[model samples]
Structure formats: C-alpha cells, structure tokens
Target: MDILVCVKRVPDTSTNEIEVNDAGTDIERDDLVYSINEWDNYAVEEALQIVDRVGGSVTVAAVGDDESDEVLRRAMAMGVENAMLLSGDAFAGLDGRGVATVLQAAAKTKGIDLILTGAQADDGCAQVGGMLAAMLDQPFASLVNMIEVESDKTLKIGREVEGGEQEISRIELPCVLSIQTGINEPRYVGVRGIRKVASVEIPTMDAAALGLTAEALAPQVERLDYFTPEVGAGAEMLEGSTEEMVAKLIEMLQAKGGMK
Candidate 1:
C-alpha cells in the first residue's frame, strides 16, 4: 500500500510581520517565516501512522516553489520514506482547482492508493483537497477525525458533524481524505530520524513533468486585494449590582434590538 500525504508551507501565523499584498493578491514575502500548516502536519503524521501499522511506504508531497522543500524535508524527518516538490511558474497564483490539478498529476504518477491532506490550508482558501478529488474522479471524505485501515483495500473513517455528532464512513482505496486537526498527536522529530532524512534529496517536478498545461492549470477563482482589518475600540463595561446590571442589560439589549 502506498500513501501520498499532501503538505503545504505557510507563513507562521504567530508572526505579525506576515501580511497579504493588496496589489497581487499574494502573501507579502518580506520578513516572513515559513512552517508547515498545523493541520497539514497532522495529516502527514496520520499518514505515517497508518503506513507504519499497515507495512507500506508513505511519501509526502507539496505544491510550491523552492521554499516548499523545507516542508517536505520536515515530513521526511518525521518518518516519511520520500518527498516530492511540485514547482513552476505555471503553478504560481493557483487557487484550489489549480492546486488540485497539480496534486492529481503527482498522485497519478505515484499510483498512490490513498491521498491525505489537511481540511484547509492557512494561507489560502481551504478547498483544494476536495477539488483535487473531484479532478481525479475519486471519492473524498472531509473533516475526518479518525481513520482505521480495515484492510489493504478498505479504510474506515469518522467525521465530525454539528452538535457533537459524528458521521462514520468506509471508503475503498484510491480515495482522498481531508483530515481534521488533532486526529493524532503529531510526533516530534527525534535526533535519529532527523539526521537520517535531513540530507535526503527531494525530487522536483514541474507542470510539464506532471503532464499539466497552463490552460488546464487555470485558477477557478481570482483574488482582487487583501488588507488588514481596522481595529475597533474597546466596548464599555457595564458594572453594577446584580439588579442594576440586569436593568442595564435589558436597556442595552433593547437598544440593540435584542428585545425587538
């Protein structure tokens, strides 16, 4: 069984310097720190765990420029067998559909049996995994919280729904799964694993190598601009005795149409 885990390198959200450019609809690259998307890391860990249990190879792949190599190397350091980086100018400024096209091309080349990805990426729209499944003409299950390999060809997955309910599903091989965060505790890179895969070469593939065309890679959506939201002033605190506070709450609610 071969599993392909899709990972993404995103700007660390903790850095206040990271900002999106309004002109090009791209992330402001200056003074930026890159790390794997937290959710996608979980997906990689999950894929590794499954492959470890089932006795197979796990390959981590990413769609980005040269910066994405670090993200793939990180996954390899965590026990993935190999890594692939999909690149090219054609892949730039791609939305969900374009990304899916690239991933589908890579997966097809690898003859992957199962594809795992985060439910959404942090930097861009979160629709790539499902769109990739659609482009590949394969089944997909999103928001997966738990996954069990029932056999070499079947997988049982659990998804979370509203009201704390869960929807369980069983899917055959060659399907896509957009996993939820916290599905498993992602493992830290040990000294040995890091040393072993840190120097491992990551292969690069372009649109031509992946059998993709610029027209076929057109984005389904377009971004106009981006800007930080203006910070609003703090709300006034209404402090008083219990009875007085209740009256003030009623008045405030009425003023805001809560009682209308």
Candidate 2:
C-alpha cells in the first residue's frame, strides 16, 4: 500500500493571537508561529500507522511556498518515506478546486494506493479531499474515524455520523479518505526527529513540471474581504436561586420560541 497524506502549514492558533490585517483581506501573519495543521497531523499519524501494519510507504505532500518545507519535513520526521512540496508562482492564491487539481497532478506521478487528508484544514474550506477524489475519479469517504485493512484491495472504514453514531463501509483501495481527528493519537516529533530529516532534500514541483496550464491554475473564487463581523447581542446571565433561575430560564425559552 503506497499512501499519500496531504498536509498543510497553518498558524498555530493556540500560540498566536490571530488578528485581521489592517487591509482586512487576510490575517496578520507577521510575528506569527506556524505549525502543521492539527487535523493534518492526525492524518499523517494515521497514515504512518497504516503503513506500519500493511508494510507500505507513506508520502506527505503540501501546497505552499518555501515556508511549507518545514511542515513536510516534520512529517518525514514522523517516519514518512517521502515528502513533496508543490510550489510556484502559478500555484499561489488557489481556491479549493485549484488546490485539488494540483494535488491530483502530483498524485499521478506516484503509485498511490490510498490517500489521506484531514477532514478540514485550519485555514481551508474542507473541500480539497472530496474535490481531489472527484478530479481523480476515485472513491472518497470523509469524517473517517476508523480504518481496518480488510484486504489488499479493500478497506473497512468507520465514519462518525449524526447523533454520535458510526457508519461502517468498505471502500476499495486507491480511494481517498478525509480522516477525522481522534482516529489516532499523533506521535510526538521531538527535536531529534526533526533534526534527522532536516538535511533531507524534499522534491519541489511547480505548475510547469505538473503540466498544469495557466487556465487550469486560475482560481474561480475570489475573496472580496475578510473582516470580523460585528458583535451580536450580549448574553443574559440568569441570576437567582436555583429554582428561581430554572423558572426564569423556562420563561425565557418559552418567550424565545425554544419551548412551549
């Protein structure tokens, strides 16, 4: 099983105080800490575990500028067999479909039997995995929480559905899955691990190398602006004795059409 896991570099929200740039078109990136997206980290770990059991190779790929190499190297440190960086001027400012197109092109260059990606990217629209599957015309399953290797050609996967229920299905090999977090505990990548792969060269591909035409790389969607919406009404604190508070809450709920 040759698996490819899509990853991304994103702002470390926990460590960074994210703010909108003065222009309001994007976040203030200056002086920000960057790291592999939390969800993508889980996907990389899941891919590693799958390869460990099935005796296959795992490759991690990212679509970004030179700054993305760190995220790819981190995955390599986590035991991925390969890492790829998809970058170039032509690849900038791409929307979801555009990203899927680039990844599809890269996947064709490798013998990938399974593709894994986070259910959603921290700074993305959560549409790449499904779109990539559509572009590649492969089977796709999202929100996957469990994976069982039924055979070399098939995989039994568990998905979290509505009402906390799990839906299990058998998907064929060479399919794409958007892995949900909590599927596995990601292994820690310490300084030693990172240093080991720091010097390893990661191959970079551009639109020209991927045979992507200018038209194919064009973004269909455009972001007009990105500003925080105005704050809504403030919350009302129900203060009183427990019984009195319950009565007030019920009255408020009834008045608000939330109850009879």
TM-score of each: 0.90, 0.94
Ten contiguous residues with the weakest lDDT in model 1: 16-25
Clashing pairs in 1: none
Worst 10 residues of 2 by lDDT: 117-126
In the range 105-171, model 2's lDDT, one tens digit per residue, is 9999999999999999876588999999999999999999999998999999999999999999999
Candidates in order have lDDT scores of 0.87, 0.94
How many clashes show up per model? 0, 0
Please provide, for model 1 over 1-260, each residue's C-alpha lDDT reduced to its tens digit, 9 standing for 90 to 100.
Answer: 78899999988888647666757466677878889998899999999888878878999989999989888888988888889999999998888788888998999887788999998887546688888889888899999999999987899999989998999999987899998997999999766876777777889999999888889988777777777878899897889899998999999999999996
Distance from true location, Cα of 230 in model 2, Å: 1.7
Top-scoring candidate (TM-score): 2
**Model 1 spans > 4 angstroms off:** 22-24, 190-195, 229-233, 240-247, 254-260
